[model samples]
Target: MNFLYLLVVLLPIAFGVGWWASRRAVAQRSGVQVSELSSDYFRGLNYLLNEEQDKAIEVFLRLAEYNHDTVETHLALGNLFRRRGEVDRAIRVHQHLVSRSGLSDAMKTIALLELGEDYVRAGLLDRAESLFSDLVAMKAHAPSALRHLIAIYQHERDWHKAIEHARRLEAMTGEDQAPTIAQFYCELADRSRQHGARAEAREYLQRAFACQPACVRAFMLTGQLEAEDGHHAASVDAYEAAIEADSAFLPGILPPLLASYARSHQMDRAEKFLRSLLDRYHGVSPVLALTRLYRQRDGERAAIDFLTAQLRQRPSVRGLMALIDATMDKVEGEAHENFLILRDLTTKLLEGQAMYRCSRCGFGAKAHHWQCPSCKSWSTIRPIHGVASE
Candidate 1:
């Protein structure tokens, strides 16, 4: 039962016991002691109702001391401290409870878990990790501890360890974690690529595909690696596959697609892919990219005409900047000066704008994060569709 329910039931019994004892005391001596105890109880209740937490804690602590067997009181007090962000005090309380001679194994593990959480909240990650590892080793609270350990490894950027723990969590809970695990493998591939371990990077990317066949990041990485090795045709195929995997990532796909098209001299295929993108993507990136392509192939006038027409359909700050750049070369005197000032103002307007946001937690970032920093949700942060961004 909850503490409040127990208190409601036991407080009346205690009051009756006190009253009967007071009646006996009256026969033996004066009523002074009974009146003092009654007044103290009322004072404690008044402190509770007033939300005078310090005084309430003082009263509760005294009552628990007087009634030494009250495990529920101590539990309530410990939970209160934890909720108040007094994690150290909560740890001490829970530790004391765990050390008690009569505590059940279940209660002891619960206290230990609470204390481990306190360690985590206090930024004592090593201590928290060790404690949670012990819980997992003992197979008590293994699922919760494994979840926490996976989160800790993620925070530490230990993707291999995170993947191991996540696997354990899935096994213990019988829950599917392939998508998240695939992202972890992608992280491993990215790390290997950064360290120039091409073989290891390819292996991890292959593992990511095994876990999630439509993993776009894996495809993008494969395409980049293929291009770096001068396999331009394969690179073009992989980039196109990446687009097919996740068209929501159009901004990231376009630059590489354009590069691959340039490398393979496949303007026809590039135009077809870009046209398909224009139908699906509301962002201005593909529009600007196509404008550049037109200007390079045809002329400035054709690009300008295309952009001016597209701007009416989807106005964008970046499109405006592109327009100014495209038109400014032909502009002269006061008009050029005015265009320069306008460009400067537009640059200022977009200078500090966040280009991505975590859909789950609303964490704004200049660059995208696969997992939200605030909420730790996977694949939550994406490019913001805006006048200033894609």
Candidate 2:
């Protein structure tokens, strides 16, 4: 019945109303005033429980006007307004709270924070940036302010400011920001590389690796930079390092790494690396890669045998398709036609399959993303390992 929403959003307001009523009963000599305020509070709570937010806002605003010290109630109302996507009303409530002459510094800071968030939700980044920057400078709610500032910088694609504020947040909170900082550097590197700034891109990648030694994206960018300069051997090394950093990224790494191996005539290294992965990584990617490698180096019979052995262990639709493709030529007539049908069925089985998913939000995607599109988190979307996926 959506009572959960009432508990999360209106519970605090209800408690605050009860507390205010009790304080009034103690301080006021008039029982009539106490009964009126209590009635108003209950009426607002009833509206909230019924999911009539507009009527609830009206009753709560009246209560705020009646009791000057109901700061918590006002804050809760502003938050509810923002949650309901009524940003203008949220801004007004917070602005009124912030402008009150006798408001405490702490309460004012809280209201300002809310106002800044409302500004962000309304796409007034400049106002949000100014307010949050002022909060940081005043050392009031500095950590939260810094985080909001970083988010603003990220939205603006200002990596330098994002990194600066991330470091500041790290210093303030004593939590490691190296991994996220590395991602910011990687973003800068990707931009530089796309603009034909190879040296600048390389430098940024070095900084990314310096922050997080096992950053897979940094290793991938390193491999791309080296490969562009015709340094296939170096590119191969970087791509292999990427896999070692995170074996879950094998599907993304193996294609480019294999190309580098072939360009540098490092088939022997490719075979050795892929074979080594078979024990540590349980995904079908390494097995499929090794099967193709075997097919190229040995013969179709050897490839078929290897794929057949691996399919029993992994049992993947992709592996089955590869096996059918490899062995289709070896059969003729009815057998070949049947194999073609099997291959078509297997292909259909894999159609529209989500190859990657976000661990944070469970968002599924057909392609890989460095950040989760749903959660907006870095490095959370990973390849899904299953019978029909990587």
Candidate 3:
């Protein structure tokens, strides 16, 4: 069990044992020793209840020194130290417990797990990696050890090892790791693309699609690859496929898709696709993009008319900025100057606003992240449909 869970199971037992021992000591000795032990016990409990973990750890440490058999207390104390960000102290406590000759295999494994966590928190990832690898080989806490190893590989950007361990974890636990494995492939693709390894990147993207056929990131990357090779038609097709896979990534796919449409002389097709988005998406990006399209094809009046009508349905600061820019050119002196001031205010209003939010963790970001930076959940961040955002 994890240390938090161990605390839940062991805390009451520790208190019960302490109370019983105090009662027995009262029968044998003068009330002095019993009272002192009782006072220390209650003080430690009070510290824990008050969230004064440092003082609680000190009290528990002293108690563990005096009571040689209090392994549970030491475990709880070490866990508290780790949770409190005192990794060195936690490592010391767990390392001591791990070295004790009387510890059972079960307890030793648990202590080793906690010590591995301490090493991870201390940024001694190599040490933690070695310890967890040993645990996995022993098949004693294999799932937990494999999970830590996967996390280490992810941190190290070792996608091949990460994929191997993740598959092992899935085989052991019967948990689906397909989506995560697809993301690892995507990461590999991105790294390959960055280093100008087109063939390797394409191979990785193919693997990603094989793992998850509807992988939006894989489609987007495919579109990017096609675009980089000046294959606008293929890029447009890939971008459209990406949208079909996941419309939630509309904001992310739109810019490249629009550019590809322009490069391929497909404005009519673009209009139809964006018009379709107007029905499906609540965000104002497509609306703003369509307004610009109308301005370029028809005239300022048509664009203004379209934006004004859309603004009635979905009011947006960005739409307002667009409308002001379109209107400002026709006006002069006071009207144009006032419009400039209003545009500045609207721009400032949107300056620090988050355009995206993580559905899982409620973390707001100015840009989209495929994995939530806060919760590390995949495909959770989406465009925030609001007046100041998308």
Candidate 3, after superposition: displacement of residue 130 in Å? 0.7
Q: Model 3 Cα displacement at 50 (Å)?
A: 1.4
- What does the lDDT read for residue 352 in candidate 2? 90
**Candidate with better TM-score, 1 vs 3:** 3
- Superposing all C-alpha atoms, what RMSD in Å does each candidate have to the true structure? 5.5, 3.0, 4.0
In candidate 3, which residue ranges exceed 4 Å CA deviation?
Answer: 1-15, 18-39
All candidates in order of TM-score, best leading: 3, 2, 1
Considering every candidate listed, which one attains the maximal lDDT?
2
Using all chains and alpha carbons, the TM-scores for the candidates as numbered come to 0.83, 0.91, 0.92
RMSD to native, candidate 1: 5.5
Could you give candidate 1's per-residue lDDT for residues 1-390 as a string of tens digits? 377975786688678758754875676566665565555555666576667767867776776675555565677677767777888888888788878998777877887788788788888899999999999999999999998899889989999999999989999999988889999999999899889999999999999999899998889989998888888888999999987998777677778878988998988787777777787878898789889989999999999999999998898999999999999989899999999999999899899999888888889998767788889988888889877787
Worst 10 residues of 3 by lDDT: 29-38
Q: How do the residues 92-125 of candidate 3 rate in per-residue lDDT, one tens digit apiece?
A: 9999999999889998999999899999999999
Number of backbone collisions per candidate, in order? Answer: 0, 0, 0
